[model samples]
Target: MQRRNFLRAAAIGAGVTAFGNTLTRTAMAAPAQNGPGPYGPLQPANANGIQLPAGFTSRVVARSGQQVAGYTWHNAPDGGAVFADGGGWIYVSNSEINPGGGVSALRFDADATITGAYRILANTRLNCAGGAMPWNKWLSCEEIDLGFVYETDPWGAAAVQRPAMGRFKHEAAAADPVRRAIYLTEDVPDGCLYRFLPTTWGDLSSGTLQVIRAGTATSGSFTWGTVPDPDGSPTATRNQVSGAKRFNGGEGLHYANDTAWFTTKGDNRVWQLNLAASTYELAYDDSLVSPGTAPLTGVDNVTGSSSGDLYVAEDGGNMEICVITPNDIVAPFLRVTGQSGSEITGPAFTPAGNRLYFSSQRGTSGSSSGGITYEVTGPFRS
Candidate 1:
């Protein structure tokens, strides 16, 4: 544990102090109907200006334009994922800057020491949220109207463009090997959900891109229709297929347990799609929150844990990362203070589930260059 202690003390110096480790779970301070979430109510904001549950502590991992280990971190850090190496792990983050958007990575050893920092994808525009593939590839997405997905390697390999995934303002992607498909979300106000079925399970060279076909209901039966052109030149992908269901400002996505969960920022709702029954329903809607005003809004990048706890990060609403448990309870697990102008991005858990990594796309100064990445460690439910 000396290494971890060193990480708190000397890893990033004043920017990485840890706190709020000595409190008991007596009572909570959230909605009453569904009770408190897994970690109980959050304590006062710590040195990093974050309010976490008792026994949980946070540290600054990287900051925009600041040296992380040696290399300067990228601005507007967004959509990140962790990949396990032999002994260490790599966390790759995408830059949301318009002209020079790309992907930057932070490498950490087994003891959490910053071994190195580098860029994986370069010269790309508006690189936003992405997903970590089962085969160790990072599917970095773009938020532009005609952006493409870049399959970048976590171990410093060259990046490849995956245009076969379709084009039209992509937000996030989640692969489901059980169904042999990768689900995608669009960022437009009335964007349609999509799926790319590769010719081979592990390869992404060629695939049949399809869109979800359903009624306008939040929960219902659905089907997929193939898109004639993944390129979306003369006709955009969303308008190519008839009856394609529209989501209000689709954002992040994740696949697990034969279900694909995605978020829509415009409506502040997390949607659940059951692959087995072809059914879709709302997992969390701020308007439907019970017994109090919904504690979550500005819903953005979402990631889940082994315990079925879905940690949903906010884009602006109080800058909190709310947890939606399997039992349908939603509560604020942690909140970042003085970040009202910034949004929470890339809420990902490590392979061992011991720590959570994310970033405030714009820090307290309310500028892209002020972005800050953080890691929170505690007794996360396993």
Candidate 2:
């Protein structure tokens, strides 16, 4: 299709939007329950190898081993968060290396150009995925035994590790701003979902770590049990508890719309936990759906759209970004083509919701040594 004609056909209910295509009835519309919105079948990517819906375009902001300013762009850029800085924003990315892995902070201009990049936390192990706090801090998780989550300033500051939050291959965390609670996910096959209730809100130095025990399918009333060892030692933390509920592989977690949305890689399931009602329910389970029906599998890092929908990234195969609508319908939002075998991680949107930032943990060659951070811009619901 010609560029002009393609743009014309892409326009649906909305006026000419900058990015994101409006879903037409023929373009993989959401389940009947989910009303129309600004998402549909992906258009051929104009960029090197990424396909986004019409109006949406992406640019490679940072690539592994690329030197920008003083620091070399970190390899294996895992989970990250975007924070509003002076005029533009600072994107903090994690390095998933074994011995010298840590967090790197990049300063971008208002136009999203890299101004400077530097290492904030160094000498950590397998810094995988983490979340941002309500108080303007990024929690970088170390996916290792007895690994601690480091709270670092996104604008280049020293990091303080919070061991009280529990260990055992931590993946990501979500903060409940209203209740001052932090929800965490473990990355092991028998990982347990944890919640830390700090003595004082926003203070992570001291807290009571507990695990969830669900009574219903995915939603409903749930109970909690204390974790005897927040730090793994003689016995693994998950194994220490007698009946601590286990998620196959708790990979990514995000808190939005008064609920906590998370994914389990082992089972390819996305779950929703109502913070107010204290219940958990399965929102999307790929195993329950026939093969080739769902675009999402190996669900990894996740973020929230302005419309209260959840954007989930695939870790291994497929390499697609899937959206879970408010009514629980899951569909394709974007797919990474040319980047062979690399999984998507760290899907975060700016506060304005106009731009979405994420990283390809393994670069185009699918090697751990290469990775790239990218941003997609268009009309994202706010």
Highest-lDDT candidate: 1
What is the TM-score of each predicted model, taking all chains together?
A: 0.91, 0.87
Give per-residue CA lDDT, model 2, range 129-216, as digits (tens): 9988767788899998888899988877688989899877899987775677888999988888988898898788998998887643
The CA lDDT of each predicted structure is 0.81, 0.75
**Could you tell me the TM-score of candidate 1?**
0.91
Candidate 2 clash pair list: 19-55, 19-56, 218-280, 218-281, 218-282, 219-280, 219-281
Q: Report the Cα lDDT for residue 70, model 2.
A: 73
Error of 2 at 161 (Å): 1.2
Clashes of each: 0, 7
